[model samples]
Target: MATASVVVPAREEAARLERTLASLGRQSFDGRLEVIVVASGAATLRIAREHGVVDRVLTDDRRDGPGAARNRGAAVATGDVLLFTDADTIVPSTWVRRHWRHYATPAVVGVGGPLRPLADGLSHRVRFRLLSDWWYRISWSVGFVQQPGPNCSVRRSAFEAVDGFDESLPFLEDTDLSLRLREAGRVAYDPDCPVRTSVRRHEREGYLPLLLAYLVGYLEYALPGRSPTREHFS
Candidate 1:
């Protein structure tokens, strides 16, 4: 019976934080669950408390990047398992349970699930979900399984073994973590444990460009400096 800590790194995401916490509150896990929200603003802290779901909240006034914020939360986490998700992600009722069940096998060091890109319109939802689901399925089936940061979990020991996420990476940090996790032990991908994530990146930057940027980031992660493109959080 391993306890779990859910860390959500937020940067001025008060609006979405409410929904994210709401979803977490609905989770069906019976284990000792600890939820921490590492946010940068007073508003975020207020919203987090308003939701009345999180077990703990860390106020980082520096507004550090996702990796930094998450690392800060991980440092204080007191659990055998560490689960990471974004402030904009709406996890299913079985999200925590699904990830925890994977740890039943000793060889499983980390577990990653698929992303369900959310949209308002019916057409938009269908289009984004189909493409994203297909892409993740193919990527996971191929061996270089990349976990969406908003829907991934790792054993505390294994996470400490890889030294956790690299705080310097502005983007594609999850992919880098995945590579190191694979070296330690098996990293399982469960399509059934999908999480609903915002498509705001594509909505703000255009779908094609966002997709191209992710592909470029993946290449850079796979091939290092040889890749023609560089990652940018902006």
Candidate 2:
């Protein structure tokens, strides 16, 4: 069986990490898979231990962002495939299984797509879920897709070739890495394999502010001549 290493980067997300670990323990992937939780604080070790995942946790100081943390985890990972996910997400029972299938395809280097957000409000929940779900359906039907980073996997070699993520980015480092990942190989979406994540981060940033930050991020990246400052707006 092909070995797979799942890297989950977390900060002070005790409230959500517990459930994330729980879901991981139940993944239905048909290969040897182990999780590496990149925790960037003292509390992270406690949470990982409490959740009985310290056997695979790596505690680091908060100096490095998720990109650095992920690299720290990857350095010790012993797998052919490197999967990444957020500390505040829930994997489907068959999430890993589906990803493994995709990774088995020699032509595929990375697998990922949208994350269906579960909101507290019923109306918002319905709207976001529908939109997220519909996007998956549409993207797959069109044979063009983009990953959400939190739900992505890359060939270990490809990741190393890109020198991992650009640790310089504070936020949207995932987006930066995704761009490089696309250049390395084919990236696609799995409509049936969906992961649900908390919108707390988005909630923390608020709708208008988050939307503006997203727009600024796009503009900053698109400008090419100038660069954007670290986005702490969220």
Candidate 3:
């Protein structure tokens, strides 16, 4: 009977937000599911309010980035579990339920799942499978946990203990949060709770270049005596 909250941070993504909201409405989780939309743009806020399934629509005119917006959403969330996903991602019907199930193990403080490509293209599919799905599985097996923003959930108490996602980090904020959550308890990777996300960034910026940029950013954050700067990715 645990309540859950899904926080979606969006900025000028009306079309994609529509699809994301629609998918969330079909969630199989029977508990008290609260959907909060932390939107920055006018169109995004409008779309979120118009959605029949959205329980709350919080505006973020500052547009401080997804990390800040997600923090805002989590601040007001009234659920035992706080689920985070992007406006461009489409989760499955059992997404919420699967994420909640992981919390049955008291040691599990956070849960992350695989990502699939929403766009249709062989290149997108192959790249996602290798870079995303395969990488998450392998890295997790070695104790390097990564919880992508598009499909990750955390215990409310554990999130508050870590002070939630670092608002200053422009990229890899979720990974930073995951690493911190590991200190509190187990951060699990659930392969069955996959979500399909948009590949627009890769399509626009070219996959290889973006991948290299992420690697550099991750290294900066992961290496000792180094910290991540406010380098905007999107």
Candidate 4:
């Protein structure tokens, strides 16, 4: 069995981090799977230790961004495969295995899964579903496959070859990494490895504004000679 290092990037989310940790604790993967939580503060470290699900805890005082935090964590991960997910996601028990199964093909360097909304509200669910489909379409139309950032895994070598996540971008780091990873090898999407991520971003920012922001970002990426959008999305 192959080993994997699960990297979670968080910022002041100690209160909600436990739920994600608990979900990870329930994974049935029997191989060497280690959880590394990269937190931007001391508070998150304390929370990660309390949950006791993480094998390693890293602290980044810079508080640069999720991409920086994840890069820092990936630097010290002990596994050949690095799994990246948000602290706000609840991964299914078979999440690791689903990603692991694809490694049987030597040409496969990365795998991305779907993001399902955990919110019970009908409107929230509908919004999340639409956004999910939009992301899938964006990945296809862009000509570079991108899996959901909150639930994706890549071989460490390929990640390093592509220079890892682009920390310079405040948003769309996943898309940047996906495009670069595609250059190294085949990047795949497996629907069975879906993770449940919080829909609070849409809930807080309003769906229309969030959608518009994403469209603008995609446009910037699609246009030639145009600079990438530097706007940050929370």
What number of clashing residue pairs does each candidate have, in the order they appear? Answer: 0, 0, 0, 0
Q: Candidate 4, 182: how far from true, in Å? A: 0.7
Most accurate candidate by lDDT: 3
TM-score for candidate 1, please give it: 0.90
- Model 4 lDDT at residue 60: 72
TM-score of 3: 0.95
lDDT of 1 by residue, 8-113 (tens): 9988898788889999999899888889999877788888766667888889877658888888889999988899999999999999999999999999989988
Report the error of model 3 at residue 139, Å.
1.0
Cα error, candidate 2, residue 33 (Å): 1.0
Question: If scored against the real structure, what TM-score would every candidate get?
Answer: 0.90, 0.85, 0.95, 0.91
Tens-digit lDDT track of model 4 for 8-108: 99899876788898988988887988999988666778988777678988877889998899999999998878999898889999988889888778898
Q: Check candidate 4 and list the clashing pairs.
A: none
lDDT for every model?
0.82, 0.74, 0.90, 0.82
Best prediction by TM-score = 3
- Across 27-80, the per-residue lDDT of candidate 2 in tens digits comes to 777778888888865676688877754348877776578789888888999989
The best-first sequence of candidates by lDDT reads 3, 1, 4, 2
Question: How many collisions between residues are there in candidate 1?
Answer: 0
Candidate 3 per-residue C-alpha lDDT over 1-234 given as tens digits, one digit per residue, 9 for 90 to 100: 679999999998887999999999999997999999999778888999999999999998888899999999999999999999999999999999999999999999999999999999898899998988889999888777889999999999999999999987888888888888888999999988889999989889998999899899877776655654222111
